[model samples]
Target: MKEARPWLRPDRAASGGDIWKKMKTGAGGACGEDEMSGEKTILVAGTWDTKDDELSYLSDVIRGQGGQVLSMDVSVLGDPKLPTDVSKHEVAEAAGSSIQAAIDSGDENTAMQIMGAGSARLALDLWREGRIHGVIVLGGTMGTDLALDLCGALPLGVPKYVVSTVAFSPLLPPDRIPADVQMILWAGGLYGLNDICKASLSQAAGAVLGASRAVEAPTFMRPMIGMTSFGKTVLRYMVTLKPELERRGFDVAVFHATGMGGRAFESLAGDGAFAAVMDFAPQEVGNHLFGGLSAGEGRMTHAGRAGIPQMIAPGCYDLVDFVGWQGVPAPLRGRECHAHNRLLTSAMLAAEERRAVARSICEKLAGAAAPVAFFLPTAGCNEWDRAGGELHDAAGLSAFCEEMRSRSPVNVDVLELPCHINDVAFTDAVLARFDRWVAEGVISH
Candidate 1:
């Protein structure tokens, strides 16, 4: 139905590869005149054919907040109830497919995938050109996927939001989610403008516009330092470390070593988002190595490999996470267990596994092209690993230490301090080593 388009990038569809491709050019038009009016242009994205009234209501709510709305129709079904700035056909075509092709294939899932990919590409193009300040979409499961894809296309700062019936399901894969993208459970967002539906739509629209107005892309004079740690039970050193880091003129961003948090940390580091990294409590590493859902495959690798000055610690290395008592796997059933809460538990790791984890960590860090520092506190790695505590595993931890020291890369400055991970001496040792690296010009203060 149109001229040939050039491809810029190919993205995976639910079907497979090449089902969705971003175009180099299409209807690359601005959303509206709001770009220069000091008014935010909010992209109201959804299947306008099915949820017309709901999408329109959101647009009205956004406009009421003094923001302009760009209705990007991603519908693949019948005619749209309302006209959109970017039409469904445009979105489909932009994704290296067409709505008619999807319709001919007679697959709702495939059609949604094509439109979602196209819509994301279009939204990103518009965003890159400052045509839209934020995006808001409302839907059930299919709509949620499309919304998530669009949100993923934008970076950390843009106001991307999804009001979805399935907000907490597949969205749990934090690696696929953009770090700052927000979501609201779609209690009544899929249907007409009733009292219940209107309340949620209004909130979503307002939240996005407010986010757009309030969020400024972070600019910094001092280099930002990214750190990873768990909760208080495992973050005793971080409390002293982070403030000292800030006092020395480095802005530090601490990532809780939850599965998703580590996912974000990895993404941010890979993108050179942080000038340096202090990956202290890499509990996710053990989680990944032991089939725990919260750990990521590349937890400790990105920061160091980014050629940034990184200080790596095997913090909380003695335990692997299992949620609740019932979640303890059969293999770890009798192991020393610490109940952090009704929802979270830590199980003591075995010596063989600890040694394997340490070797793997060294292998990962071996690719570092910048200043690398590895420190191990020989006493223990976390609260439950210290004296007379539950989940103690000094034998396993020492095994890790021994393996790490043997495999430590020549470029890395490795240290084994004779103190518990939470002890003041351990913190002091970490600071002193970092200070030395800075003085040696391997890093800047």
Candidate 2:
């Protein structure tokens, strides 16, 4: 019987060192320019031990598919900075020869954790620097862990492909991988070049490179507008505000008030990506005040501080989002709660809670651009806040509105709409304010 070959053996006959030298030169060349090679490149990177041949083979396939391929070896050198390319000897030298140290014998879990952290950091650095257009990985179960670590590190638009021997087996939790990742099942291990490996990898390379170069919808050059919503409260604005702003040549981005959505909205706004804000349902404030799910961390109005024209509305301030009736905290249980669906439950705020919510809201909106408006719909903010829904409470609404207005600074105009927020009149009114701001150059047109 043939002896099983060690996975760390190098094909020394090949001039892998020359490739490493070229890579070091190319890295400097690529970093100086905002754009990369006219043709997209895929970085085929992995361990530099016995896996060096596999990297070379995959890089060859990608290059054949009209892509420029760069190689990376994930070995930590004495400096701990990644080399643009590294040879097998350099890798072995960097990582000590103890196979035990490399194997991560703490447990299967520990092995996965170690692989994920290292691979993810390397992939993130590569992608962030725009050195790679797409990524493909070929590996075993441990490889799968590392591959996904790399995959998850890529930004939302970039493509990631993984060909793993265990893809068809039930040994690992697929949930460990992201839903957007592309996975292929490879029979046995990827030892050498073969028809199936070549074909699949070729297709993946073409798919990623092709998509990378495809004509994308031209970026919306007009100012971006970020808004907050939930499936329910902002339903009206989704239909009305989005198109209205788009017609006026402002790019619209809507974010849910769920924990991260509001934060993301503020982040993009502060980053100067968005020119203005139409912060419509801020139910996250209620969540924050009443100990409910979907609570946006404080700093909700940081966008206004960046000098963006903005409008704040108490679209669904009456309710705090919860997961289920049982999930409602003890203090909030007696309050009026509505089950919008199995997934989202909300509680109506009492006057006292509304006052606190109002103060927090006022604090966040401190420095919005001139002509900023804070509107309240007297009839209702959401369907639940109307005449007969579970959240309906005229006195509660009045207390909330009055408190918010009294506490907030004069720059935040307090407007009262007679109709429900979804009413066409309300839409027209909000659009009119948006138009006035743009026309006045309070926000760039």
Best by TM-score, which number? 1
Q: What's model 2's overall lDDT?
A: 0.63
Q: Rate the local accuracy (lDDT) of all candidates.
A: 0.76, 0.63
Per-residue CA lDDT of model 2 for 1-445, tens digit only, reads: 1111111111212221122233324432223245643777776656544455555666776677678776655532222133445332333333333224445364655544454555565555666567776777767766676776667655434567777777756574433454346777764336765777666656665666676565242133455677888774435767878887888876787887765566556544543445677888787877876777643465465566555667878878877787774677787878777777787777778877887888888877765544578877778888766788666788888888788768988777887888888788788888888778777766675
Highest lDDT against the true fold, candidate: 1
Q: Which TM-score value belongs to model 2?
A: 0.63
lDDT of 1 by residue, 1-445 (tens): 1111112112211111111111112222232324544888899988888888888888888888899998988888776765789998899999999888989978888888888779878887888678888899888988887777888777667788998877777645666677888888777555566788677788889999998888765443455788888878566877998899889877788887868888888876765556678888787887888866464677777766556678888888777887784688876788877777898887878999898788778888888777788888888887777778676766777788889888887887888888887889988988897788667766654
RMSDs, each prediction?
A: 7.1, 12.2
Worst 10-residue stretch by lDDT in candidate 1? 12-21
How close is every model to the real structure, measured as TM-score? 0.84, 0.63
Off by over 4 Å in 2: 1-39, 43-131, 135-218, 232-234, 295-299, 325-331, 369-371
Superposed Cα deviation of residue 17, candidate 1 (Å)? 34
